[model samples]
Target: MKIPITAFEKEPLKDHCGIVAAFSTDDYPFFETGLKGLRILQTRGYDGAGFCAITKFGKTKTYKGIGMVNEVFSDGKRKNFASFPAQQWVYQVRYGTQGIVNDANVQPVLLKHRDGDWFCVAHNGQFAKDRNKREEKLSDTVLFAQELARSREASWDERIVTLLQSKRGAWSLVIATKNGLYLARDPLGIRPLTYGHLIDKKSGELIFCVASETGALEQMGVTDFFEMLPGTIARYNDQGLHILHQDKPHQTALCVFENIYIQHGAGRAHLPRKGNRQINRSPTIDDVRRKSGKILAREAPIKKSDADIIIGVPGTGIEGGMSFARAVNIPYFQAITDIWDEPYEQRTFMSAKISDIYQKVLDHFHFDAASLKDRSVVLVDDSIVRGNITKGLVYLLKKFYNVHAVHLRILCPPIDKPCHLGVNTRSAKELIAARLSGNIEKISKALGANSLAFLSVSGLKEAMYTPKNKNGFCTGCMSGEQYPINEFGEPLAHRRKKATQIFLYDNVTNPAPILL
Candidate 1:
């Protein structure tokens, strides 16, 4: 049956990458310029965004989340000359809060290390906790950042040494200073970061760019390239880009989400696989949409006797409609604006009554009745999470359009499970599919569609992995690969042992690595 799309579909399945951008020479714009670079990462997340730029005065300035970049910077004007087109470095981050959401917690954290200078950082990927006394261990990340500042001699090499000394887990990082910028990923390479460069037309000078996605690099028109291998450090300075691979093994296990939903469809980042032929690394949401579309096209292309017009519900459906149209080779139209397309953008349309639902859906962008007058419309979406939005949209569509029939196509397999990683689906009350109320048809008809077609689990697995290249991904939310609560997230069984002070930062020498 059609997978009704839901808001959580866009959440990054994992903490993927961190974006660092800076103007070393007094040339490019430097006012939270990382924001400008990360604008391309909007598809990665819209919930929050933040950036920090290093200053020559050893002062670090930041403009952080709680709002859009434009909205956050709405009142502040650039007054510091230290950050851009002059003396500075920039780092930006998106996706996942790690439960540390605060202006204090927002990265890139600029602070003094043990050396006499300043260093700033932006990190991606989860840091493995002590598995016991997780909170005590959690405090260590800050202490670790503090310790790095304390132990180092305050130089470019020192910052690298300081970061290197930490036994912390996966992180894709950017550390900046007065002389240059240092970029590195964790030993495990659990996150993704890449760089390419171009010459600026305004100044006719060469520039290096680093970003979380290739789409960001492509926007700047840096076509010529080579990848910064995982576990490598890239430094930008007067001499130019200095690259060094980590002394630690550079083996990579690229986060699979980069292809599934993180990177926009520039599969050119594909890697060498199977036989030595290269494959695209990060796949785009559009790629998934296209495949879902192709699937719908194969399964149920519109027939002449079917409906007068063809319409996709919105967002997810838009692609499926195109797929169905192409598969059936018929006209595809934007039947309505997806109520959740700009899910967060609808906060202003709020009212107190359920009856007001119709008005809210209408107000937030939906249906162009002119084309939807009396045609059988096939609606496609990726998944239906809560069923509230889907139920509302169907009611709104039928009431407004004297449509022939409405068919639903879902690109994703039925979400029979809840996700534990970043998504907050531990509770069954939130998942409509998790209700296990009855048979599949009962669920589809209950949602109010003429017919429902869901991509089978195998189909979803094939569609997601084909064309793009990657091992396997964490599809725990769809197939019950895992339950929401992870035993790993649980603390080490502290009850048996006395509540000893566990320093989760720097070194674990206090207890030693000895087996108790």
Candidate 2:
């Protein structure tokens, strides 16, 4: 399934996967808590859902299926989940970044070591593309599991750190053993991971929950929580939480996409504190996306009369588009409407095939041709990776709807490189900005736009950054700046193509691996 860059030049960019691990002091219905946490994190991943639970009696149970969290955990399945007496739980919602979508590929990867020990893992980020070339058959999580099982380290935390140091990419992971639960983030912190607590009022006992987003913890009724520092590992057990290992971040490269599109507005993220691990003040995503819009306007203001009205793409693009319109003093209109009936509204740009993306875009959006007819329009989207939908939208407006002209504006800077941090766009060749040599006019011509401009990387940082911290986001895709821990030896595209055949090794022998 080697897709030529020309036909699939623009695939949709997807958020990284999601992970959750809960340590319960009492024999509460921990499975439901894990499911609720996964439900809140559904946005990060929708392709599949699964969970692994260990009961107080040392029995382990796991259920995984390909679909949305609710779809996978149906009413009957929920009842089954409830019947399991679990004391600790680990859950995962997966988006296939490097592996094919199948039952085995669906995660909460459980592996049984040759030594008769069992381990289960759920990961939220990606290893570097080059890291998997030699073993194209293994998914990053599965590969990490195999590597961990093979490691000689005696402690779970050391085994995890060994995996982190050996593999280079964005990994915010929760690795669970029957004994304790461990959480680790990559040194650069490209993916978000946080932990929160819900105290039992009766006994004042603490129940700790960890997830990809703080909002997921809050969904489970957690009130007090804190973000983890990059290059840190936290282990939770009967004794309570302990920071077993913490490393100084070589450079804090928190993935910007989380703030822009992945994370919900309510989640709080922060830069490293001045001298401590505690981050006192965190920025809300609502503020960051809106500020990005204002900065986009300031950086690339639309000329007067250059466009008659603004058409902001819904949900993800609207906030920035509205701010851009206001800053540019242009009339903003809700020209494009999403069809609520079409519940499967794939962000067309994220599709692997151009035809699928085009069809999805047409099905998802309907143009109000009567209002937009014969008027110049400015089209605003949050970010452009493949440029398929933007180009298609321009063609739809001008060619089909008879709009006077369409101008394209992007909120983020040009993505000229592949994201090695668990995002779906893992190859530089797939990026339109990279393909077009970063030439705006050529991109404009290709997209059939009258003109096009993008917010500069510095401008994007300015908009997203608080006055207190200027550079806290990962713009690795835009700047091609290597993160501190890239282990270069393999090719991602080659391995991704072969992933299905090799990575599903456990599916044949055991639907679930590493069952202790």
Candidate 3:
């Protein structure tokens, strides 16, 4: 079922659905748990949701749909599940933020991890260098998995571990191999992961559950919990779960977007790093909501003290505006629009490096601005990406109303560069802010917003899980800071430094641009 644009993107916040898995000895209602997790993630995704279970029959069963979990699974009641518990399953609600959103692209990208033995996997972050390697090429994940298959001669878990060690950037993934269950995160805690337990009464058996957030575990009556450390693998068995690895001090590359866009705002574990040196810091999901509101209240104070209506653009900024509205004692309002019916997701275009800002903004909404025709309004959104979409929104609002000024409040700071982490941002030409000559103020004016403000970098950091722990993210997009890759496997660098006049492709390559 379609929803309001702001509602579909959950207030236009760039969050994908969370993933959860539970393992036990006997088969149980694993599908039911997956369904519940997808339901929670439905608020985060729209392209679709899916889950896969490894049964005692050793058969893998998958349930997926393009609609909400309830809309898709409403016909199947939980009582119908076979009461076995020792199965491994993975659940995901995709917002089409990364990768492809086609039916074949919906993940837990099933693969025969060990000689035709099937393995199911789901990932939260992208592999920076891996994406570029497949650009303008067909099938990114297939090539990615194929490479993984070639690099190792071990169990699926070992292959995944080795694959991660060899690869770079933000990634937290889980796979269910025939041997057991495989779980691992990046060396730095950019994405959050956690686990808890649920006991079966009939069998007196205990099951271990892993998820992107603690909230998913909480929903399954597994309140007793522990956060999964980065680079750690927790293998589930009849003896409970085993931590095969622990969060370590390596090439730290946590994604700041986890706090700005992804994540469910659970706490994080911080592993601070300076250049290549790693140190411990508080790890917790940052909560940018209230702090952004407080900052907006201070920087861009509204005249008349309160508005007839407070409207958040949706998602991240909605929460901040709600926080701000409550503090100022004003009523919060949401302007509904229709944009969910668009045939494609903006993420699809971006992943291909296609730039179509207006369509994405229009697709993410199903709203009617007549509701705010003459009313006082404030628009809230997470962060500004390229000023194009926000400029289009300003045009749409002004066209429809004898409107008051649009007080635009963005939670995160200006995006100054392409993301070198999991996100797919290419070279310099694509970024609008990067192309600007003067200060950000000039850029905001060009976007046509009457007023605009951003949450501070310190404020964004503080909003995360905590000030210390094991969490840190790679914000290479905002600052051209790199994670320092070794001389090997640097394609873009190889093109610049070594292959100065050489360009190769499929062995029939050219030394320069091969015009089509």
How high a TM-score does candidate 1 get? 0.73
Q: Which regions of candidate 2 are displaced past 4 Å?
A: 1-12, 113-115, 128-133, 153-158, 161-167, 200-205, 269-280, 341-359, 479-516
TM-scores for the candidates = 0.73, 0.84, 0.72
Error of 1 at 410 (Å): 1.9
Candidate order by lDDT, decreasing, is 2, 3, 1
How far off is model 3, as Cα RMSD? 10.2
Residue lDDT tens for model 3, 179-252: 67777776665565667678867668677787776556767767665665566665676565666766545544
Please provide, for model 1 over 137-172, each residue's C-alpha lDDT reduced to its tens digit, 9 standing for 90 to 100: 222234446656766454667556555645444456
Query: Model 1 Cα displacement at 132 (Å)?
Result: 2.1
**Each model's RMSD to truth, in Å?**
12.1, 10.9, 10.2
Estimate every model's Cα lDDT from 0 to 1. 0.53, 0.71, 0.56
Error of 3 at 319 (Å): 2.0
Q: By how many angstroms RMSD does model 1 differ from the true structure?
A: 12.1
